[model samples]
Target: MGACPCGTGRDYDDCCGPLHAGVPAADAQALMRSRYSAYVREDADYLLRSWHRSTRPHALAFDEPRPAWLRLEVLRHVATGPDSAEVEFVARYRIGGGSVVRMRERSRFLREDGNWFYLDAVGG
Candidate 1:
């Protein structure tokens, strides 16, 4: 369960610690990846923590049916500035019946107080 591409060597905590602690990522791309990891792991805390307050929901529940996350692929990343960035990626997964599901999204981020927060989602 410790393998995560977000570069958090000791699972989500040791790797995306700052990101989950409300510390903005140094760039947009980093934030996007960390959020993806959060979803795959069902780490609602991390998701809520990284969401921009203006758009963040009151609560995030991940206790529903679970999906078997297969792989994460970061297709492209573009940074306009320290405070703004976009990432396009695909997250693949599988559930019952050997079915495979893929989620693709172009994510946006904003930097605040030296941390990156997920601002919004574009396409999926």
Candidate 2:
């Protein structure tokens, strides 16, 4: 938790730490970054915790060959309210063969229990 999971030039304390530490983020972009961190660390519980139940699967499996996260680029973010938002982003990674892949998607989010949760992927 000491390192910034978002790989941003700031410390965790200045980045996604506040959201993970129970402090609510003011908008969708902040929540999106924290969710990225959750993916990097393979924190399934955290991912589940921050996922909207309606769209969330009963269980999530992260069985892909471990890959290093090269970068996370947030392309755009739009918020409708404290409880609804959308973010478009690309997450790049390098696999064992040194093959790089960029996952680009528009993600939806909703706030529940005063915490923002990932809702679903709305194809871009």
Candidate 3:
């Protein structure tokens, strides 16, 4: 890919690519970025894999008219503990040829076995 879908201003291979390829994320923010890239790439497998086991879904199915991811803005990243953290972000995307929609969320993450996983949405 040319640029990373996570809006990192970096090449995919130098950014989220490694994480998608099974390399562990360096931190909660890194994992959050990789997860955003996964959505853009429509890589459900990676998305499931990077999710916390307790919350991972049985399967991932994209809608017929998948949202075309536009950009991502990471508002904040805070470590709650040695193995837990949170990320707040806004992601813009559109479905088919529709108006852009902005989604904002604060997400929690947990590190286990030296690998970071998306835990869940912390708040609205």
Candidate 4:
């Protein structure tokens, strides 16, 4: 298998693949990386499953003209509280041969029942 889309320099099976396959992520940062990999793979089910129920969308639509994920750069991961955390990352992608676009976001996550779920993003 190729390198993990999260840029973790590991095979997908040893990295985010397991998370997408139903294994819970160990931390907020790990969940965030796995989410990025889900997007790269167009795995909407994984994305939805990792989202917090309170804020989860009804559905995820990877419509046409979707950007092809190129790389992920995790900037920082910090615990805001005992069960809350934040992950800041820059994801680079391009749409249909267009120039690369960088999306920088500080995403919040919550842990419930020992499972990490993405809450929302603060800035992008």
Worst 10 residues of 4 by lDDT: 1-10
Each candidate's lDDT (Cα)?
A: 0.76, 0.81, 0.95, 0.96
TM-scores of the candidates in the order shown: 0.80, 0.85, 0.97, 0.98
Cα RMSD of all models vs. native, in order, equals 2.7, 2.1, 0.8, 0.7
Deviating ranges (above 4 Å) for candidate 1: 5-14, 21-24
lDDT of 3 by residue, 4-120 (tens): 999989999999999999999999999999999999999999999999999999999987888889999999999999999999999999987899999999999999999999999
Task: Estimate, for each residue in 1-124, the C-alpha lDDT of model 2 and write its tens digit.
Answer: 3768676778888887777767777777888888888778777777777778887778877886887877889898988775788999999998888879989999998887677788899886
lDDT of 1 by residue, 1-124 (tens): 4567554345666566557666657677778777877777688988888899989999998654677777777888888685688888888877755778888998888878777788888996
Lowest lDDT 10-residue stretch of candidate 3: 115-124
In TM-score terms, candidate 1 sits at 0.80
**Pick by lDDT: which candidate is best?**
4
lDDT over C-alpha atoms for residue 38 of model 4: 94
Between candidates 3 and 4, the lDDT winner: 4
Deviating ranges (above 4 Å) for candidate 2:
1-3
* Model 4 CA deviation exceeding 4 Å by range: none
